[model samples]
Target: MTDAILRMRGITKSFPAVKALQDVNLEVARGEIHAICGENGAGKSTLMKVLSGVHPYGDYSGEIEFDGEPCRFSGIRDSERRGIVIIHQELALSPYLSIAENIYLGNERRGRFGLIDWNRTNADAAALLERVGLRENPVTPAMDLGVGKQQLVEIAKALSKEVRLLILDEPTAALNDADSRHLLDLLRGLRADGITCVIISHKLNEIRSIADSTTILRDGRTIETLDMHGDGVSEDRIISGMVGRELGHRYPERVHDVGAEVFRIEDWTVHSPTQRDRVVVDGAALTLRRGEVVGLAGLMGAGRTELAMSVFGRSWGARIGGRVFKNGEEIRIRTVGDAIAHGLAYATEDRKTYGLNLIESITRNVSAAGLGKLAKAGWVNDNREYEVAERFRREMNIKAPSVLAPAGELSGGNQQKVVLSKWMFTDADVLILDEPTRGIDVGAKYEIYSIINTLAEQGRAVLVISSELPELIGICDRVYAMAAGRITGEVSRADATPERLMQYMTQTEEASP
Candidate 1:
């Protein structure tokens, strides 16, 4: 018998208009950690669905082999019975349920009285949670845990079914640096326990550290699966395989002369809504100049987001006390609408909730911010709206079926483009893009960088907030590091290495001697 644990041959999936997957093949050896590397909307998730039976047979043309025998998975349950479990990127867990209950939800230990045996369930859950490096009490509600802990709980839940093959899709995308490292360590432990693992992520650093082999996908086809355990494997080799071409530069070139200050903050402070005495943003003063992309760098909870939102209007925090100036003149921004009217637009980091109306069509979303301008006598000019949206659709290169496509149906990267287009239509001179490339793929990220550069060249003052230091270093002329609710230190792009930026980022005002 072959040593392969899972094999997918000639998988093909098509939608009404687009062929999502085209003749893809993959093989995972027993007890090996494999990674799926691809750009956004490159059929990586679709291939995973086919492997896990989410697509099922007849929906796609594919032959799947498990343990050297032919198998057919009609649904998620069918795949689960064979020890195949997949944990999605957006975690799926009951918030109200206790950790123990969530872990043993569907499969429970029932007594003679037809009631669940809580003792047995907790005992089993505790053991599994320990294996996943989660020490939280089993009785604690799942909602009380952070995203990292919740992800570990999901892993425990998957292991409760005694899974042999585990699939994780972008597991660390929502996690912080420490949590991401802990999760990767847990994956290594699972592999040592003889469980074969498959991970799909755009984070090449983590893949280089932990994966034994990686499969590269381009467009709708599998490029190749290179062995990382061998001597010839490297990130450059993997990147070439995934992109199908050599990259001359990782980041686009930036050339823009900084002009006079366009916007400024003086003695800004914000009190948390829940805790009145607690200050989230304290005396944070900064400035943005014309034709400049200034980077805001900080560890989580350093008030980077709070400062942006507070200045953009009273979009965040309570008891806001600040002085904002535009072109050296004071501006009254009491509401978000006022901020927009004053040539300011904020793009949130959490795009799904704060950045967009997901249920609306892309055309409506793009025109939502500019409706007043497009309206004539309290009636929207349909022809004008269509023309405006069509122009942006072409400019942004939004890969959608149509402008009338629901934003929810679009991919992560495309949705982001639409968000940018929304603000672009408003003709805002000062743009606050909070984590603009948070969840996008590499190719899309390059496009975003180019767009930012173009905006700067056009004399728009761009304020970019990013957690990824390398990103800020690449694009911004200057970067400010925040710590403990204040701007700590500013660095030039040439001097903005990860080490120097992180040192300023983690430093606090109340540090010990």
Candidate 2:
């Protein structure tokens, strides 16, 4: 602690209705990879924001010391000048701008005349991309790259600044396993280069592998900092500090009583919406039984989202060929309205974009999908809407001051709850949830799992698509694996394992003839 490169003491920040951070303390040693662990709304992000000047000096009462000098930063630029840079969980990049342009956006490279030097900018960007292990062209548009590569671009942007202390907020939350590994390796290399790093992540295994020490926070207060190499510092131990209780089981236990098949998709084939010649889903078939929680497992680009979107009223692809069956009766569903009319609901993975309206009030968002049920003569019953939203808010345990609050005001976990409540309000017989627990803490994930169990217990069919294998094995009664746009295999819960599911997920040939 004496050789700490950065120290924050007695940090307290508050908003209108809530006090976010309360006397939080943090210390990061020079060139060590330190991690911050906490549940959602636990003040981890707020503390980092306060340090990086997103909250500014006067907004929070705290003493910040960087490199043994007391500092008061009024803005993000002020912190950047002091060699501190932060990359938020939701990446901030201009999608239309080229990689070089995005990297040198505010910190532009200039020539003798103080005009932008395009040649130098691109060359420098290319070098930084290489340093981050991104083999992308500097002139390529930011939108052309996937989430993983975009993360690397964000890091390259940080490197553009002469950053001494790097702070990453859930950098690997959206990445696949391979991409997550590559980013972690890059962080290790950066640590070796004597650049201190503070990473906020929910992935405990990654923290154990990369971080030198970890600080746990709960309810806006610092719990404790533990040495990662200590004799008994395990993931469960970290969870204990984060949630303030011994988390006996990561997943809640559920009774499985799967019933008759209620929904089925047969001979499903979908071509890419942009690329007509490319097949995104080929002859994919799946079934959902009443009172069952089924899982769809796949790697990135394996067409899990594509299949779900396409089946939900052809919202994704073209040249779609599929037959929908409900109780042995073939039905036609060619639009979202039609799908909803047929008792189907889809909770998207990108909740910010596709699920709930951020600017809309919580009551409105909850009643949006089920307006017809609360409508009379094409006018929504505002009183009924409020009643329904309050019911869901209490049932789902969404933390908010009031149902009139905007959906955007809630944290990630609360926002996800709103999304689920939106779909649940529709009384759909079958629900397709894509990455339901993405970017949420372990405690929130358990709550989501319990909600899914409650849904199944109510005799609703549920299809869960996720990138995490353990999640599928833990809560699902049966799982289907996809690879190369084809269903490779299906396994019952009793027979499912990460290794076995991985074998099925990596297969190139279709499981079905």
Maximum-lDDT candidate: 2
Candidate 2, poorest ten consecutive residues by summed lDDT: 504-513
Clashes of 1: 0
Quote each prediction's TM-score.
0.97, 0.99
Q: Residue 222 deviation, candidate 1, in Å?
A: 1.0
Best by TM-score: 2
Tens-digit per-residue lDDT, 324-344, candidate 1: 999999999999999999999
Model 1, 318: alpha-carbon shift in Å?
1.3
The Cα local distance difference test for each model comes to: 0.89, 0.95
Relative to the true structure, candidate 1 has a C-alpha RMSD (angstroms) of 1.9
- lDDT of candidate 1 at residue 397, scale 0 to 100: 91
Q: Write the per-residue lDDT of candidate 2 for residues 1-513, one digit (tens) a residue.
A: 369999999999999989999999999999999999999999999999999999988999989999999999999999999999999998999999999999999999999889999999999999999999999999999999999999999999999999999999999999999999999999999999999999999999999999999999999999999989889999999999999999899999988988999999998999998999999998999999999999999989999999999999899999999799987799999999999999999999999998989999999999988899999999988999999999999999999999999999898889999999999998998999999999999999999999999999999999999999999999999999999899899999999999999998999998641
Candidate 1 lDDT at 238 equals 78
